[model samples]
Target: MDILHIVGQQRLEGTVSISGSKQSAIPCLAAALLTDQTVVLEGVPEIGDVATMIEILETLGAVVTRQGDMVTIDPSRVESMPLTGAETRKLRGSIYLMSVLAARFKQGVVGLPGGYAIGPRPIDLHIKALERLGVSVRNEQGVHYMRVDRLVGNRIYLDLPSFGATISALLVAVFAEGTTVIENAAYDPEVIDVSTMLTNMGASVKGAGTDEIRIKGVSQLSGCRHTLIPDRMEAGTFLTMGAALGRVTVDNVIPLHLESVIQKLERYGALIEATDDSVTATFQEAKPVDIRVFHYGGFPSDLQPVISAALLQAKGASIVVDKLYPQRFRHVQELRRLNARITHEDASIIIRGGETLLGTEIEAPDPRGGAALVLAGLLASGETTLHHAEVLDQSYERFDQKLKELGALVWRETI
Candidate 1:
């Protein structure tokens, strides 16, 4: 396994460019299958997940070409095949393939998706919504098989506003018989980006950034060029890193997408200034903050771990509740290994701040939690050695290199 080593208590200063959204890129790449024409996506981040998605696309017989941050896919040659293989099974993003394939071909086969197990994300909602669109689904062992003679649009309501399920619904509805209304849909920026892409592909989609999304089914979709939005999660992680020390300017970010994070960091004594496309964060004498992870346009669940690590240096007590995924506190235990004063109680993690962390051996289990461990190492006194640190590559592109550019004393080693 590869390990990451970091020497702490160093001030971070410099400008770091945030990458394109992994969340947006995955679904958009899957959207390429909705059409047989050429689809060009710009600002695609070069990450492990993107690589996996590309591998799946190629296996499905799509022609993929890359240039710098741009990726062009010719899905005209795509053929429906069982999305079974080591690389295909390991991607949670593979679930997005289910709807696209089902829409393009009459039937689709896929196995259980793989990724860092943050918690249980049951696809019952996805199955339920697809059934509403006249698709029959069955599970054999760990694989899912779906077939439809022809899809007819219907009003579907998600029990919870899940981003993945919402995107799946949109993909399926694009080629359905009539109009489809999605109630309690996810209002994520990624969701909006998908809707915009579909619209660009000559589909009628409206109210994407709202709880209710309406999609008018069309006969066929034509591919178009689209640019992905900046990654808000990456920008938020950098902001949290800045809260520990020094001034760091994060460029190529959408300020509105980071509203909740910027507001929360300000409450923790971090000075944040946002322009239309960039944000600058500076550390100060931090104070504890209480936060609860919620849906999009609220405190983001994906960022809970990084903000929790920032709260470690705060004065007094801070409480964080992960209403979205209770199991997200895995980093609390890893932070404990570094002598952080944190405890888990039920759905919430209570953090008593003002504890000087001492670097020690830790583990990076998942992408977001892995990022939290890296942030903790930046504040610790001694050397912090993180095992399974390669997990960060799943979503983040050039994370260690970007941190090093900002003057972080970090390095990766194969061991």
Candidate 2:
């Protein structure tokens, strides 16, 4: 295992370019398997989850090559096979392989996925959506075996707007026989990026950033080069870090995707300047503000932890209501370990600021939560040692290096 040694009480300053979206890269890589030709993906982050996905692809006979931030995959010789149970249980996103393989081949098998144990996240939505597309799915002792003679597209009305299910549906629907309409689909920006990649590859997909997504299956998809969109969550995390610590300019990010986060930070007394593709966040001092979070098109649930960090140093109490992912407050315990005064009741967290935080040993519960802990560590007093720091690698690219460049005393050490 590896631990991160972080020296606290340092003001962060520097311009850091955000990495590509890990959420977008995973499904896009799986989408490449639908085509026999080589697909060149630029700006792909070199992260643990992505590396695992690439390894899964290689095990299925896809010739994959990596050069810096670029990944090239040739799936001409790829075959459908069951992913190893161990590998499948490593990351939740690995379950997406089921839809891709099932769409490409007549039969596919994969075990249940596992990632950070924040709460129970079942794949029933995925299975239900797959069944709607004519795929017969069966689960035996935690392993999912699926078979589909032919995929004939049909209207799929998701019970809830799930990002994973929407992406999985898009992956399989791109190669199906007829038009597939996904009603009440997730309209996340990552979904838009995947739909854009598919459209470039001759797959007719429209209404990606809306509730209704329509996919017109093409007979064959040609290989095409595509660059992934900037990671909004990564951009938001740094923005929140700047709000908590000091004035920091984050470059190479799309400003529009961060509108909700930037607005929330602005409400919390952070100065934000947005350009076409970059956002600069500067904090003079922490000011107290009331934050009310709603559903999508409002404050997102992913930024809740870092937002809570910002509120920790504020002048008054800040109320955060997470309409989505009510159980995402696992980071609150870790924040409390650093001396933050936070009280949680139901789906809301009330933060009372003006409390000085002292660093201590803590563990990251998940990727975003790990990021919030790192931000808290950077702003706390004394040294903070973070165990299981590898969890941060699941998303952020060169996270420690970026933090170090911003004058943070953070280093990775093996234990």
Candidate 3:
């Protein structure tokens, strides 16, 4: 495993253009398998999960050419095959391939997904949605096999608004026989991005940024080039880092997508300015404030940990409630290893400020959590060693280089 050695007590100030959304890119790559034309994807992030998707596509016989940040997929030579269990177990986004394979071949097999050990992320919602669309789903030998002789659209109501389930349904419903209505769907920006990609590919999809989505079955989908929306999560993470260290402006980002995060930062007394495609966050002198995190349409649960790290340098105690993944506070213990005053009780974390963090060796529990650890290390005193630093490759593209460019004393040391 690779480790990152970061020297702290430096202000990160620069214009950093965030990478493409990894959450959006993986689903778009899987959806590319629905058509047998040359699909060119621009602004794709060079991440481990994206690399896994490319490997999965190539295993199914698609000709994939990756040059710089552009990925070209030629699916004319793709053959119908089940994704291996080992490959499927590497990333949660692999489950989205089930819908893509079902749409193209009408039969697909995928194993249970395994990513971060955050919490119980079951695919029951996905299976139920697929079954509603006239697809036969079965769990055999730890693999999910889905077969549908003919996909007929119907009224599908999700028990919960799961992003993965919503995207899966959209991918399969585009080629169904009739109109498919998704009730209580996820309205995240990534969902809208996938819907936008589908619409650009000649599929009729509407109500992307709302709780309900409707898709009209198309006989076929054509090849189209679309640039992915900037990663809101990445932008939020960087903004939180800036709020912790110094004033920084994150460019090439869609500010509208970050309203929830921006509002939360403002509530915590950070000066945030938003434009059409960029957001600048400045913290002249950080003041501690209490915050309550909610679900989507509110403050996202992903930003809670990063925000917690920033609050460590504040003036008061801040309480963060994580309603989505309660166990995401595992990184709190790791952060405390660096002399942060954070204590977890139930689903909320109490962060007391005015403690100087001392750098120490820590492991990245997950992707987002690992990012929080890295940001804390950047602002800590002395040298900080982060194990399992490769976890950042799942999202951020060239994180070390970017941090170095922004005046962070970070370097990659292979062991």
Model 2: weakest 10-residue lDDT segment is 288-297
Give residue 223's lDDT in candidate 2 (0 to 100): 90
Can you rank all candidates by TM-score, best first?
A: 1, 3, 2
Candidate 1 local lDDT, 1-415, one digit each (tens): 8799999999999898999999999999999999999999999999999999999999999999999999999999998899878876788889988899899897999887887667788888888889899888899998899999989999999999999899999999988888999999999999999899999999999999999999889999998999999999999999889877789889999899999999999999989988888899999778999999899878998899999999999979999998678888888899999888888987799899888899999999788999999999999998999999988998899999999999999999998
Query: TM-scores of all models?
Result: 0.98, 0.96, 0.97
Q: Please list the C-alpha lDDT of all candidates, in the order they appear.
A: 0.91, 0.86, 0.86
| Model 2 CA deviation exceeding 4 Å by range | 289-296
Sum up the clashes in candidate 1.
0
lDDT of 3 by residue, 157-253 (tens): 9988989999989998999888999999999989999898889889999999899999999999998898898888888998988777877788889
lDDT of 2: 0.86
Residue pairs of candidate 3 with colliding backbone atoms = none
lDDT of 3: 0.86
Give per-residue CA lDDT, model 2, range 202-246, as digits (tens). 999989999999998777888999999888888899888887788
